[model samples]
Target: MARNRTRAPSSTTTTATKTQTVRINGARVKITTKAGKVTTKPALPLEWELQAAQVASLRRLPQYQRQFLLAGDMNASKRGPRAQAQAIATGMTSGEPDLRIYGEYGRLLMIENKVGQGRLSPAQKDRHAALQRLGYTVLVIRATTTTEAAEQAVTAVLEWLAQEKGKAA
Candidate 1:
């Protein structure tokens, strides 16, 4: 009789276990999959919450404003209101705010513009408070304004700055 030459069946499975990981606020987090089972690691520091809030606020901006805000070139004079908005910022940073209006005398004013359903996040409130502590006046405005409202807001901000300038002088 011919000897049986068939190989023994393999014990190991060919399917691979996959994993994904992200670090938030300096803490390591991991996600793993095994046999189609998925799991997530624990949350990191509260900094992630703050970052998420900032990102959420950024997402609220119009696409063009968002682009200019990220590019840090909104302060450059261009064509229309968007260009004028960019031109107002003296120092802009994605980590902080949409615009940083600087007075002629060097005082800083951080402005957050909202188009509709104006709401301020905890992180934004914290930032505004911090700016106030640093002697910078912070203002929040609804961007969907008539030309008159826009003019009034600008005048109010400039007038406040003038008073601040007078005090410093």
Candidate 2:
């Protein structure tokens, strides 16, 4: 059982807004939230939702696959401390990507989706580097424009396809 711990707003923080701007990985990102919504600039939208739509659209394409698995790698939840600890003890490993698209020929694409000026945490950076070292295709993407995020995913898959074809030949 996780502990329900909510910190009261400090003097520097405002109560009107749900999020505060802060720099992470050289990118300005909104921190914390209210009403379950991010209060930030218009540069980036909700990332998870955008990733969902992009994955769905890609799934319909034959190039992606007739049927594929899109696994959402959720890192956090609204659970309390105890539950959070329990989760970590179970399978909630640090630095996992947001989405895992298992493609053909055992190819895997790990996408870390970010919205607004959001950036990766230290653990995320470490994970990304580790995955890259292990010969995995990892992408840290921010969904800003209409098709930028999806386009990135497409490009990654295309590159992977080419690499796989080369291996077969």
On lDDT, the leading prediction is 2
> lDDT per prediction?
0.52, 0.73
Q: Model 1 over residues 63-108: C-alpha lDDT tens digits?
A: 3242223211222124587755564474443325455544454556
Tens digits of per-residue lDDT for model 2, 51-134: 876676667667654434667766844688998989889988788998887866777878887864687889989988999999
* Deviation in Å, model 1, residue 123 alpha carbon: 2.2
Best candidate according to TM-score: 2
Instruction: Please give the lDDT score for candidate 2.
Output: 0.73
lDDT of 1 at 160: 61
Candidate 2 regions exceeding 4 Å error are 1-43, 64-68
Global CA lDDT computed for model 1: 0.52
